[model samples]
Target: MSAPVSTGVIPELFRGLFDDAAVFPPGNLPVAEAVPAHRVHRTAWYAEAVGPLLCGAGRLGELAAVPPTSGAVGGAQEAGATPLRVGLVLPGGSAELAPALAAAAPFELAGVELATRDAAEAVAELDRLLPPHVPAAVELPRELLRGDGLDAVLDVLVDSPYRAKFRTGGLVAEAFPDEDELAAFLTGCALRGLPYKCTAGLHNAVRHTDPETGFEHHGFLNVLLAARETDRAAAAAVLAERDGEVLAKAARSLTDRQVTVIRNSFTAFGTCSIAEPLGDLAALGLLSSPDPLPQEDR
Candidate 1:
C-alpha cells in the first residue's frame, strides 16, 4: 500500500517498474523460496525499482504456507515487519476471482491480474466481485488486438475502475507479439489514456533476440519509449529498435515530465528475474550501483 522506497539511485521512470514474478516460468521459482527472496528485494539498495511479489491465485495456499520474514510489504518497516505485499495473478480468468480474493485474505493485496477471452464478462464479474480499493488489470486475448475487439474492451475499461494488461511473451515463440501488433496496442491505449502493464518476454532493458530460443524479445526500455509515442508507426519503430546505446540515450534524455507521462501509460511489468533487468540498467549507465547496505539492514 505504501509507495516503493526510493534511495535516490533509481530514476523516477523505473520506480516500482519490475514486479517480481519468480514463481512464473521460465524461472518458476518455488513459493517458499520466493517469499524470503522478495523480502530481501524490499530491503535491497534498489528497492525503489521493485514492485509486488506476484503469485498465481491457484498458488495462494502455497504462498500462505511460507513463514513470514523480516521485511515490510513495500519497504523496511521500523515498527516490525508486516505481511508481504502481493499481486494475485489469476490466469484462469474472472471465474476464479472470487475464490482468489478469499484465498488471498492473509497477504497485503496490491493488485490483481486476470486473463479473459470475454472482455464484457470479465468487466461485469470485476464490477460484481472485485474490491473497489484493489486495482485490477484485465488481460485481453491477443486475437482481440487484431480486430475491433480491442476497442470494444477498451470502451468498457475506459469508464470502469479496471485497466488493461498485455502479454508480451510466454513459453513459445508465438506468445511474443511482433512490433506492429504491440504498436497498435500501445497507440490504442495512449489514445484512450488507458493505463496498462506488460508480462513475460521483457527479459532485459534493450530489445534483443534470445540466442537460445531465437525469439525476438521486446526490451522494457523499448516499450517505455514506444509508449511515449502516439503514432502507431513511430511506436512500432521504437519497439523494433535493438541498439542499447540508442535506447539508453533516449532514456537518459527524458525530462521528469516525460518520464511521468510515459510511466502513467505503461505502469509496471512482470519480470521473472529482477537481477537481470537491474544489471541491464546499470550496464546502460542509467542506474549507479549503490554503496553496500549497512550490515544491520542486510
Candidate 2:
C-alpha cells in the first residue's frame, strides 16, 4: 500500500514562521491573537507586549519559547521564568554578527538563527566567523532540503573549510524549492542529528492543496516530525516518493493547535496577551478585555 498521507498540518521540515507586527484572527476572545509574535523582535515593546501574559494573568505553561535578546533583557519579573530558549537573529551576509554576539556577556544565548540568501556561502562565513560556543543555523531553501537534494544541499552548507568550527543546525533558505531538493535537505538534517527550524511563508498550517485558489498553509510541523523518527532514506522516500503514510505517521505526533505560551513580548504567546507596554497590538486582533485602549494610541 502507498505510504499514508500527511494531515497537511505540518511541513516536511522546520516551521517557517513569518514576521508580523500584529495579528488579529477576527475573534473577540483573547484566546488567539499575537502581535509581532515572531517578527519585530525589538526590546522597547517587551514590558508592554509580554509582561502581562507571562507575569500578569498566569503562566503560559511549559512550551518552546524563543525570547529575542532585544526584547527580553529588560529584567521583567517573568524574565526568571522557565524558557525553552533565548534566541537572536543575525542578518544574512553579515560578518559582524559573530563579533557582536561575542562582545555581549552574561546572556545565556541558547541558540541563534541567521537569515541568509546563499546557503553555502553563509555557512562558510559563519564557520569562519562564529565563536564555537554559539550554535548557529544557516538558512537554506526549505523546499530544497525537503526533497532528494537534501544531502547535496547540506553537503554544500556544511563540510566547508570552517565546517568543523560550527555544529550542524537546520537549513533555512527562503521559499520552497522542487521536491528533490526539499526532501534531501530535511533528510540530511535528521541524519546529522540537527534540528531544523524554518522562517517566512509558513505563518499558517496547510499545504496549498488548492493552488488555484491561492490558498496555502505552513509546513513546519510536517518537516520536523518526518525528520525525527525516520532515517535519511526513509524521510527522503516519504517526501520524494509522496508516500503519505510515512510522513503522516510522524506528523500526527508533532503538530498541535494549543495556544502558544508567553515568554516575552516578541515571543509567540507573550505578544498575544496585550500586556502592559505592548497592549497596542490588541487593536489589530480585536481585543475585549480590560478597559479599551485610547483611540489615539491605536
Candidate 3:
C-alpha cells in the first residue's frame, strides 16, 4: 500500500477500529513476516485506529520463538522492544485453549475469538474455560439463525459479559451472509446493546462483488455505518449498497456522539491485510495523512 497523502485526520469514531488478521486466510502471511508488519502498524501515524495482532491459539509456539524487535508501540516495556497486544482465535473445542492462554499470559491479552457450536453452548463453555476479566467473543455459525436458536443465543450473550461475533465472509461462497441475514444480526445487536466484532470477507473499504469468485463481500465502512442505524431496514440498505461514495458520505456525516454509539456496538473487524483497509480509508478521505512506513520497514 502506498503512503496516505496529507489530507484529513481519522475521526475519533474509527480509532483502534481494525484488528490485524495477517496470519489468517487470503493474506495467509507466515508468523515471521506478520510480526514485523504488525510492529510497523503499531507505530504508524494512524496507530490509534489499529487493534491487536490476531493469531490462532494453535500457533502460540511458533510466535513465541520470534524475539521482540524495535518499533512496537502501545504497551511495550522498553524502547525498541515490541509490546504485543494479541487476540487468540480458539478452535471449535477448548482442549488447546488452556495451554495457549497460559503461554500468552506474559503478553497483553486483548481478547479471544472462539468457534463454537452455537450461542448457548458457547456462553457456557466461555464461562467454564475463560475468566470473566478476559474479553471473549463467540462466533455462531449462520445456520444457527435459521431456527429460533439465534434469539435465544443473543439473549444469553446480552445478559452475559461476553460479546457476539458474526462471520461476514469466508473462502467459499457459503461463508458470506446475505443482506437480510446480516441486517437482522446487526439490528439484534444494536437493540440489545450487545457489542459485536466481525471477521473474514471484509477485505476493502466499500462493498463490491468479486468478479473471479462472484461472491459479494461486505465493506467495513458499510458495517460501521449500518451499526449506527436503529432502523433494521435502513441498516440493511447500507449493507447492500454498492456505491462507495454514498457509504463515504454517510461515514463522513457522523457526529461524535453518533460515532460513540456506533463504535460501542460495531467494535472492530478482523482483516488479513491491514494495509488494504488503511489504503482504502485514505482514499475515502477518512484517514488523514497516515504516517509513512518507516524507512527501515520499507
TM-score of each prediction? 0.93, 0.42, 0.89
lDDT of 2 by residue, 112-228 (tens): 455555667677666776667766555544444443445665566545422111111112222334334445555455455444444433332223232543433233334333344
TM-score: which is higher, 1 or 3? 1
> C-alpha displacement of 5 in model 1, angstroms?
3.7
Off by over 4 Å in 2: 1-72, 75-86, 102-107, 115-129, 141-153, 156-174, 178-180, 191-194, 203-215, 228-298
Pick by TM-score: 2 or 3, better one: 3
Better of 1 and 2 by lDDT: 1
Off by over 4 Å in 1: 1-4, 71-80, 292-298
Residue 236 of model 1, lDDT score? 96
- Best of the candidates, lDDT: 1
TM-score of 3: 0.89
Question: Residue 219 deviation, candidate 3, in Å?
Answer: 0.7
The list of candidate 3 runs beyond 4 A from truth reads 1-8, 71-82, 293-298
Q: Give the best candidate by TM-score.
A: 1
RMSD of each: 3.6, 13.9, 4.2
